[model samples]
Target chain A: MHIPFDQLKAEFKRVLLKLNFTHERADFCAQIFAENSRDGVYTHGLNRFPAFVQHIKNGLINIDAQPTLINNLGAIEQWDGNLAPGILNASFCMDRAITLAEQNGIGCVAIKNTNHWMHGGTYGWQAADAGFIGICITNSIANMVPWGGSTNALGNNPLIIALPRADGHVVLDMAISQYSKGKVLQYQSFEDELPFVGGYDGDGNLTKDPNAIIESKRLLPIGLWKGSALSMVLDMLVSALSLGKTVKQITDQGNESSASQVFIAIKPFNA
Target chain B: MHIPFDQLKAEFKRVLLKLNFTHERADFCAQIFAENSRDGVYTHGLNRFPAFVQHIKNGLINIDAQPTLINNLGAIEQWDGNLAPGILNASFCMDRAITLAEQNGIGCVAIKNTNHWMHGGTYGWQAADAGFIGICITNSIANMVPWGGSTNALGNNPLIIALPRADGHVVLDMAISQYSKGKVLQYQSFEDELPFVGGYDGDGNLTKDPNAIIESKRLLPIGLWKGSALSMVLDMLVSALSLGKTVKQITDQGNESSASQVFIAIKPFNA
Candidate 1:
């Protein structure tokens, strides 16, 4: 249960290479996955690896594909992820953004056809480590009901804002959902009821029971209507900026592939 | 009680002139105060005007002062607000940022020694209407306790993000607090319990009583510890970017003047 970090990364790299990933792609992605676990983000680390591998096997992720730029408008660039692994594609895009910012003070990259990047904080940390202020967002499959609505129709899309500091890079990464589905699953795994009402029950009453919430699939968005509006706005921004599929379109695809994401890097003036 | 907008603005204008404000300054400040109320932010508009006037009278806000540029590095500029009214200083800074973005792809302006911007969304809408993505944030007097700390040591600092949209111009203006102090006062006026647990009682148990919360000054930050961390990180970013006062320093001020803020504008690719 507590494998060494290096072993975990090596295993991921082995699997990815066996699946035909290029040497560079397997090494970079496997390192990120291992780092997520070592840094205590279990949901996106070891636990997520199985689901990630499954997605690739199911053709939701294309191991050999990479992000390719499609449009360039001043400091903004649009790219197609080519259904690539989200972690690799995200890193590639942020690198591009950083390069552009180094030349133009600020840069933005929007990509479509991305898979889940796992923990969003990784990208923020990457940018901060590069001496840039970074903001990143991604639109996911709808697992949350819009506020004031009883149906599931919104994504608990995460937002990350990081500022480079001499001390630990200040990073704020949060999902619009009060409790993400992974968090609920974690609580259920521990056989613990959530301390607060995480979502609604099948009968439509707020409930703390993690199992009931997972069963009902009525995850509560953060701050009710506030988070719903935020989710919609973030979705619109990522989709519009990337000129890619919206959440509605992503869900209609019947699989959570080809999602859209946006990454921005602002070169710190002082840096 | 429904005052004509012009009459309300003119009355404010009259007071600022009496206080020796320049003609342009008085009119600019008065117009924003009136527009805030018209846009349904009465808490920061008419209701707060008396206190704002009192601050000037008490010499808390420096009526004759204006922001002076401290540094300009690439597209980022830093200003010292010279203890001016937050609304005036913030508008000017955002305007400067817009000018920078017009030249470059993005621009940032961070200000120190400012007072509170009555409505953060006002500046956000300003940038969105200019067809750019806008973001702004401000640190406040400490009013919320940090996570795991019973005493207040964090500002319920507001963060605003707006994207120019074809419809509605998606703007999110939110404080880290679950319910802002002004909102609690509104609930108290109606003799109503907060619909949710807005803060902890004297004994640190969650409660809905607006009176108790206001008395305690122990407002709950949104998402419990999540917002607390966010507010802290935001304060750090503002302080670092402007090389200005931190929340700790602002709290040490006898009253809530001389706060710091940051504004950023990024040109959309399409434009």
Candidate 2:
């Protein structure tokens, strides 16, 4: 099932072109998808393409709309994503942050009304490749129970950090959940149990079985209480910084768009 | 056992006065230690006081040496701590970052030759109180086994992030280890097994027994491979940004002094 990276990218580009995407847009999106698979993130790669297309077709994603500046606060800028493609908006915001960093050594950009950006690592790598350290995080619809609670009331809230290095840039992309939804689905495909405790089963016992976890919908928070606190912190940060939708607001919307996100870029002097 | 918080603060002040510390200096240091415990971080509070004294007594800490500027790169400034008490140096650097953020909307300070910052939350609270978001991280001597390796070659680096809020400023203080050295000691003292799987025993099997983990010194990285990569990224960031000692260098020095640290402060616009 492993296809050559170039072939995978070409296939993606072919589909995008057939969907009437501009050639440049199709090429860029295809390359990113290929890079995700090449870098060993299969969940965000080919496996997720169908869901992405479905979202586009459902009017959940506004493929042609672009982000517009809503406000500017000195070194910080706020943007409305216009419900555009998440990947494009994220990349644009990070680009703005890098430009700000080049002028001021540090810059932060926050965006609202964006779709899922697929792998957060993509923007992290983009910043590092441009010779800057980067950090980004996004809130999602509630899929986790708050600490000391027994119901879903929190988001997995993925976080990404990358450091620029002469050698391979070090990047970390993590979720507050022990296993993300995509990861749990991947495990379910094999009917395999998680190697470590993942989530709760029926009747509230910790279980490694992906199906049981999905059935119960109580994903274990990473580091138990620590992850819950961290997720709250990130949620507060994105919401407060961007003045955008919080996890609860996103949940109320009934779909996963219009989430809050923050991107920060810092550059070395020599850069 | 669970003494009133004020009594603990007074006791810490008494001990510092007995060590010939000036009255004001003693009060500042004691208040920080007490606050750490008040915020439920007992490991860095009363329990760490004796070791702080030991460092002072051994002439390893320069009680009166102040941080001095090394370089300034626009929004970023570098300082040399002169081997001062870790808490004092950390507070001073955070104050500098706060000042910079107030003027520029963002500020980053990196310090070399600094001692441990005690509870990293102290600095986070400092920035949050100043109406700025705060982030601080410190590299330590290697105490973690890298991914896919049995030998310890990574620092259990601590990262702190805090945001100002109308209710309580949300703060997250985390070490990269699944169980920090302090928590392990706590478990050992309480004669209780870890509530969940923590580190690995000698045979690389995950175990909840504190004694087995401490004896093996093979503490699990938080989130296994995820934390290993995060640790490496943080180490590289602290070292590279400050041009100070890396975890490898700190370990080779045979002790955990003269570490590298970074503090960042960002001001937010009115929502």
Model 1, position A97: C-alpha lDDT score: 85
Poorest stretch of ten by lDDT in candidate 2 chain B: B217-226
CA shift of B144, model 2, Å: 2.4
**Candidate 1 docking quality: incorrect, acceptable, medium or high:** acceptable
Worst 10 contiguous positions by lDDT, candidate 2 chain A: A70-79
Q: Report the C-alpha displacement of residue A265, candidate 1, in angstroms.
A: 2.6
Worst 10 residues of 1 chain A by lDDT: A221-230
TM-score of model 1 vs. true structure: 0.95
- For residues A159-268, could you state the per-residue lDDT of candidate 2 as single tens digits? 99898878788888888888887899889988888988888887878889999888987888777876787788889888877888999999888888888999999886
Task: Mark the regions of model 1 whose C-alpha exceeds 4 Å error after superposition.
Answer: none
Best by DockQ: 2
Q: TM per model?
A: 0.95, 0.93
Interface RMSD of the predictions, in order shown? Answer: 2.4, 1.8
Model 2's TM-score against the true structure: 0.93
User: How would the docking of model 2 be graded?
Assistant: medium
Give the per-residue Cα lDDT of candidate 2 at B153: 89
Give Cα distance to truth, residue B6, candidate 1, Å. Answer: 1.2
